[model samples]
Target chain A: MSFLAVEELVARIPDGAFVALPPDYSGCAMAAVRGLLWRPARGLRLLGVPQLGLQADLLIGAGCVAEIETAALSLGEHGLAPAFGRAWEEGAIAVRESTCPAIHAGLQAAEKGVPFMPLRGVLGSDLLGLRPDWKVIDNPFAEKDPILLVPAIRPDVALFHAPLADRAGNVWIGVRRELLTMAHAARRCLVTVEAVTEEDLLADDRTAAGTIPALYVEAVAEAPGGGWPVGLQGAYPADDAWLARYAREARTEAGFTAMLAEFVAR
Target chain B: MTREEVLLLIAEVARLLEGCRHVAVGALSPIPAAGALLARELADGAMRVSILGSRRHSPFTDGGRELFDCAAQGRIDAFFLSGVQIDGAGNVNLLGLRREGRPIRRFAGNFGAPYLAFLVPRLILFRTDHDPRSLVERVDFVTAPGSGPPGVWRRGGPVALLTPCCRFAFRDGRFLLESLHPGHDLEEIRARTGFAFALAGEPAVTPPPPEDWRARILGPVREALAEVYPAFAAGLGG
Candidate 1:
């Protein structure tokens, strides 16, 4: 079992690699993101599975991300993601604008080992016009009906934070099945956990159902409070005050830089 | 807009959601979330309201995936979507201004709008900013098309577009002026609107929210919204 430091694990991700991050509400590896920022990893192509929040914004602000493919980038109720907006406006990063279901469809295709997946929406929309890569075809089964098809999204590495992992390296991610899809679709999976248990998670039928076997996971690192400020489901609550402060202070480049220096650099 | 105007807008949205069985409010939609909660309360729990990011409101354990699945399965009766720009054709542009190679102004990427717009029976389009820039003649990008081609399998599309200026009912791939909000007239709406729309006879003034509805929104609804939207809820005046 290769248990590496968060820095080492992040370092293994080569520049320009397609790295996928989970949704805001899902288990986000904010600790790993902080580690990457500290290392100042560059030229990454970040993938947002339907949505993105703090992780994407920070990476973009830090100039670590070269490109981003996502459904949306917003801080939810915290309002607009300033860093992401600034980067986008400056044309600093390449963006592949996509819809939520389409992203999910692409990931599902990758999980199923398919080249592409057909979706039911985006027809006659400018999203179709923008994404020349996405093709429209007549449904063979149903004549005269057009449908949209999106290519599979297989990331080079799927990174996320989880509540716990057993000695066997199986991570228990109850109800957050999209994380499972992410792991299955990616070439490799790197996970940060709040705790590493000596108990076998798969031995118990209940835990086994929610557990992602060690076979999919490439590396496991102990990262307590890894998803700080963002919150890890069932493990912690989102630091609302910190998030609010980030929203207020991170409105400008200098403010954002200062925040990174204090929160990440230190 | 004033707090009272905002409350009225919420109430109008709640009115549109009158008979909806299940209404889902997406991320960053405090006003719609308030409206849905209000509708649910008025229905005496007969209506199910699910706001994304709220543990109490959202029944799904699997996050957005479950929400999308439920929406696709026709389980969601109504849903709310907003955009940086909305056109006369009922198209919404969540993606900001696009140049040849990249966007000049990128607000946010399109969330699950495309699929949900087609699947949900009642898709209520709302935007607080009501001006020529927002109500454009044509969107630079269509994140969720208000209408699709005849052969496209669409069970739902935009039912009503409520702006601070007026309410537009979408029919046959076009928005028709239904009613102008109070303190605004048809002439003002026309002057402000960038896109052209058919008039529904004489545009009536939007009815003000009931006293009870206003009380509910200013009271319990504000509390409910605080769970998901602390900043917006906290900003709401009593």
Candidate 2:
């Protein structure tokens, strides 16, 4: 397994890459996201595995993202994600509105190598009216029953940060199995971790059950505190003061840029 | 909002979700989380509460998809949703407001509403802002509809809509005013409401929140709430 430098790994992701990112609570490859920003790329597409937060907001604000598909974009208790809110209000980015289960179902279809997945509900929703690709067909198995079928979403890359990675390149994500599904559905997965273990993760059964084998992982890089500001489940807590300050200042474009300057400058 | 007001809302939510076996609350929903916890407390720990973001409160070990799968299997009985715009017909718009078919204002997009609103038997819709603007005659977009076309698959929908002014029960595709909170009158509700609703008889004032709230709310409830919502718990006062 080749463990490249973090930015070197990020350099392989071309411009306009359709990247899938985990939700805020889940691990986020913030270091790689910042690495993408430094490359001066544009028109990158983002897929929020159901939802997103500061990572998506900052990317959108930095003018790297051209389109976003997600169930919701929010900062949890911190408040509305200001940059995405501004872009949404201005119609600067094309928004593909979706629901939580629908995104999961779509990805599951891809994970299974299926073309589409049938989902419950959304028969009369106005959201369905806008999404022409989302089709409603009679349930072949049941009489007079209708269901919605969403096409599979196969992203160009799945990027995230985790607590641990082993010498064999297996990443231990513990009970957050959604990350596993994401790696299965995406073309390739790129990961950054707080540390790299010397021992084989798969050598132990306890860690093996929770590990994503290197077969699914495209590359690995060790970037300690890579998921900062956003917490890595079971590893750290969110920096509340910094997030609150972001919520307060990121309301204005000038404030967002100022914060961005202070961030990369670190 | 005052602590008493929040407790009042919690009491109302608990009343609505009295006997549900399992209730799943969305992330950042302090009031609903508290209410579900209170209901469990009232049930003598016979019930289960799943607050999405909190590991201590959640039963999901399989990650985010398990919650949806659990709801689809007819397990989750109660859930909560708040919309930027809610119509008389029980359609919720968490997405931005549309003007002339163009989105002008955006709120947080619809999270899990489209599916959960159908599967969860008791869907509680609440809005802290109860003005005519928030409560509309028709939502610009139907993120989640209370009623659907004939043969459209739907298991359940809005049981009741809670607002600062009053509580309205959903029946036959429209909200019918159920009761008003103390210090709020029917006239205020009527003036503030954007849509017409049915009234069966003289509206009754809801029972006041217990004065001994600190005993229940500030004790175990606050401890559990603090675990998920530390700042909110820290801000809670008698």
Candidate with top TM-score is 2
Indicate the docking level reached by candidate 1: medium
Q: List TM-score per model, in order.
A: 0.92, 0.97
In candidate 1, list every pair of residues with a backbone clash.
Answer: none
Which has the greatest lDDT?
A: 2
Q: How much lDDT does candidate 1 score?
A: 0.86
Candidate 2 residues lying further than 4 Å off, grouped into runs, are B211-214
Model 2 captures what fraction of native contacts? Answer: 0.80
Per-residue lDDT of model 2, residues A1-266, tens digit only: 57989988899788999999999899999888888877766899999898988899988988989999999999888999999988877878998889999999999999999999999987777889778889989999999999999999999999999899998889999988889989999998999999999999999899999999999999999999898888788888898899999989999999999877766655
Judge candidate 2 at residue B8 and give its lDDT: 82
Chain B TM-score for all candidates, comma-separated: 0.95, 0.96
Supply DockQ values for each candidate: 0.62, 0.80
lDDT of each: 0.86, 0.88
Candidate 1: tens digits of C-alpha lDDT, residues A126-211: 67776889999889898788889999999999999999998778999987888888898999999999999999999999989899
